[model samples]
Every structure is written in C-alpha cells, then in structure tokens.
Target: MKLPLAARVQEAGAALAAEASRFSGYGWMRGTSGNLSIVLDRDPLVLAVTASGLDKSELTDRDVVLIDADGEALDSDDPRPPSAEAGLHAHIAARTGAGAVFHVHAFDAVVAGHRWPGGVEIRDMEMLKGIGHRANDETVTIPVIANDQDMRVEAARFDEVYVAATAEVPEVPALIVANHGMYAWGADVAAARRHLEITEWLLRFAVATR
Candidate 1:
C-alpha cells in the first residue's frame, strides 16, 4: 500500500526541518527570516513548508506545516499559519516545476538587490556552473522584485516578472527580492540548497570582483 500523500508530506517535513536548521546554523535563516519547503506532489499541489515567525534554529517537524498550492494550511495543526512568504514559494514551484524551494534573507542578496533595480548580472564566473547557468550570453541574470508588505502583491508581481527562457531572461535557479532576500528552487531539497548557495555566492562574487 502506498503511503498517503499527507503521510509523505509529514515525512518530508521532518527531513526538511533538519536541513533548515543546518541553514540556520550557517547564519542564513537568522531569527526566522528564511523558509524551506519540499513538494509532496505537483498536480494536487501539496507542500511541506516551515511555519511563520518560528526561529529556524529551533524548528522541528511540528514547525513544518503542510499546505496546498495556494499556500493555505492543510495539516490542521492548531491553525498556526504557514510562512508569510509561502505564496511566493508556491508561485516559484508552480512556475519552475521545482520539487523544492528555499528562501533566505542573506546579506549578499539584500546588498545586490539594493544596488540593482532591474536585475543583477553575474558574468564570466565559474560559480555559475553550480546552478546550471548555461547561455550564449556568457552571464547569469537574476531578477529582483521589490519587496512589499502585502505578500499577495509581491507574489503577483513575481508572477509578472519571473519568466525563464534561453533567449530571453534565461532560467535562473534563483531570484532576489529587493532588500528582502532570495528564493532558490530545484528538483529536490539538496538541489535547491545548491541553487541557494550558488545564487548567494554569485552575489558575493559580484561584490568581490568590484
């Protein structure tokens, strides 16, 4: 008998919580500013994601909430809200066909976004290989969306700007929110982590080269 999707979501939550904590240890999540998720299913749209306002260092499996594609809580764990940015996570996952998404309020993303209103261009860097950046343009461009208090508005804005293509903007594994942070995604948690690391690295690399 196959495990129920809910059960699998729960399992994924447990695993993701550990990974999120590790990210916290890297000083990334810093006081609940970051969130992580694992997609249970894409069609029915179930996800195991961190809860809102919880300290990432102390996050447990219970801190991970199951939500639908719309970011509505589904696991019925005393109605505690999902991450405030869950909608953005869902939007990225849906748009990119990612199985996992990770968001972090890292320093490089914030600095880079503040410097570039249009987008951040990472050119001629070896680190680009980590996130699968391959293009004739010889550079990786990560879009930046201005942060908004109303996450719904921000999510909608994200929907408008974040289209990936080879000849156009190109498919970056990540995008930054101005003065907010970056969201990185991939086919799984490990891959998403790699994307996050590479994206953050590219920002720092850009700064270092300057």
Candidate 2:
C-alpha cells in the first residue's frame, strides 16, 4: 500500500511504540522509566518523540509529539512534555546524525553501571557486528559514565565521551550511563532499532556471563 508521508511516519512511530512495548516486556523500561524517539524530518528538523510519563505499552500516535532541533514543541495541541531525557536524545542526534534515539533502563545496563565507573569492555563478541561495528578479537570497550540527574550535565558528559570514543571506535552505535540506562542510535528508525536491540542483547549476555 502506498502510504502518504504522514501515514508512513505514523507507521514508523507505531513500530517504535511496539519496540517500547517489547522493551517493557523484557523489563527494560519499567514503571515509565524510558523514552523513544524517531526523526520525522531532518532538514527543517522534526522529531517524533514519546511524551513524558506515558506507559510505553499503551502508546499511540497521539502520544507522540513533534519537536524541533532546539526541542521546542512543533505540533500537537496537547501540552504534554517530552521525556525528561529529551535533551540527551537531542544532543546525540545533533552530534551523531542519528535518525532515531532509544533509551531504556535495563537491569544489565543498570547493574553494570553500578560496577563500572569508567566503562565496561565487551571484546570479541560476535554481537558487536550487529551494532554496525567490526567484531574482532580486539576488545570493544564500551565506556560507562556515572549517572547524573542534571540533563545538561549528562549531555555534556556525553559530548566528552563522544569525542573520546570517536577517536577510537568512531562508529559504535550505543553508550551506557552508570546506574541509569542506555542510549542507542542509528541512521534511521529501523537501524536505530537494530542498534538498541543489539546493544541490549550484548549487555544481557555480558551480565549473564559475569
């Protein structure tokens, strides 16, 4: 079926919603603890982001809000706020050219965060290939920064991590925040979904083995 651009966007939003539900089932986004976003357009800058405090499993098109690069609300008569971590998502999108960003608080990521103040190293795992990076015998050190409540501070920390990380693995798709959650992005919504799922799987495996 030839869906209009709006319909296509809605479809993508629905896909993101479904992904959120799956994450919830896995206990990744428990008790309204996570957010999801997809780029509707990039040139003029429009992102379809999840509204704050909504149960992800019950998400609908109306639950999504359109925002600009500055994170200003662009569409929707509803005065609903975007997720609290919207700034972090915006920062990643602006810096990485990612078409979508997904954040969730999975047990592995949170537990690993509590242990690794610097970061966690996942080396030689075949799953690394799923994150659009080469999986080799070499160690893939995924840096984990201490979690912060201030979004601005959190965003700045991410900026530092981005610069340092690009110096090593310039194309890694996801990052971890200690005791917080994970941030994964990709070239488009589907690609972003792949990155999120792959990173989550890797973390789950790492935790299980450790």
Candidate 3:
C-alpha cells in the first residue's frame, strides 16, 4: 500500500538529508550553497526540498519544506523556506520525470563549465558507463546553460539546451551552469547521487587533463 503523504514526506526528507550531508562532507555543498530534492508525489508533483540558508551538513529530516510543481511552498507549519533553486529542481523533475535532483557547487564542475562553455564532452572513458553512456566509441555532451538569478530565466535557458534521450543514446542525466555549478538527477535519490558523483569525477578528469 502507498504510504500516507505525511509519512512519505518524512521519508523523503530523511533521504534528502542523508544525501545532503554526504555532499556537504565532500565540500560540494559548502555553507548553504547547494540544494537537494526528492519527489514526494508525481501526479500533483510534490517535492521535499532542502531548506534555505541552513548548513547542509547539519540537516535533519525536519530540515526540508514541501513545495509544489511551481516551487511554491505548500501550506505547512514549518517556517523554513525552500531553496532558492527549488524552481530549477521542479523544472528538471517536470522535464525529465526524475524522482530526485541534486545541485552542487563542486569546484571541478565550475572549472569545467568555464572551460567548456558550450558543453563538456566525454568519450571512451570507463566512467562514462556510470552515467548510462557507453565506455567506448561514443561521445556525450553534458549541456551547459547560462546561469541566472531568476529561476524562470534559468529554466528557460535550460529548455533551449535540453535534449531528450534517444534509443541509440542515453541522456547524460546532468548539466552544468556556466560559471556556477552542476545539476544531476536520476530515477531516485541513489541514482541521482551516483550520477552527481560520476559527473563530478568526469569533470575533474577533464579539467585535470586540460
């Protein structure tokens, strides 16, 4: 049976907190610079996003706030506001049907975005398989979109560059924001975390080699 919404929300919050803490420990979410979210419902598109301005490393299950498809906070007694990038998370979830989305300010991601403003391309690397790409004879571009303070503008920019996956090629499942950071998503929290890590590793390799 499906769990109650409240129960599901609590579970999502805990899962998000765990992932946030892991990323924070890696210094990817330094201070409150990054945000994470998980879909609590798909039909109405409810999400549990990390609260704004809190130390991600210290977050508990209660540290998240519920938001709708538009990133508007739902009616709740919780006084915390959702992350400023909650809308982008909502946009990604809506566009990709990803169950979880994570944004991080990893140094490598920023460097790679600046180095490859058009997009970061990877090919013939074993790590590529980590992101659903072939380990050889295939090149994939992780799209890079211009960053904007306005979430609407950012989402619009993403729409222009976003490419759907095809039968012959799997989507990279991540993108970089030029001069900003990276956003990675997947079917669930675990997959999102793996994509995030693998993409960051790939970026680090690209930056290091260049």
Best by lDDT: 3
Which lDDT tens digits does candidate 3 get at residues 35-114?
99999888899899999999999988888898999898996777788888999999999999999999999999999999
Model 3, CA-based lDDT: 0.91
TM-score, ranked from best to worst: 3, 1, 2
Estimate, for each residue in 1-210, the C-alpha lDDT of model 1 and write its tens digit.
868865786678787888888888877899878889988877788788888888888877677787788888886745789988887788778878899999988887898899887899877777787877653457667888889877678878887777665664457888889988889999998899898988888898776676
TM-score of every prediction relative to native: 0.90, 0.87, 0.97
Which candidate, 1 or 3, would have the higher TM-score against the true structure? Answer: 3
Candidate 2 per-residue lDDT, tens place, 98-209, comes to: 8889999878877776766677778888888887566886676666776777778887888776642354565667889987888889888778878888887887788788
**For model 3, how big is the CA root-mean-square deviation?**
1.0
Supply candidate 1's per-residue lDDT for 186. 92
Weakest lDDT window of 10 consecutive positions for candidate 1: 132-141
Best by TM-score: 3
Candidate 1 Cα errors over 4 Å, as ranges: 135-137, 165-170
Candidate 1 residue 188 Cα shift, in angstroms, is 0.6
Q: Is candidate 2 or candidate 3 better by lDDT?
A: 3
TM-score for candidate 3, residues paired by index: 0.97
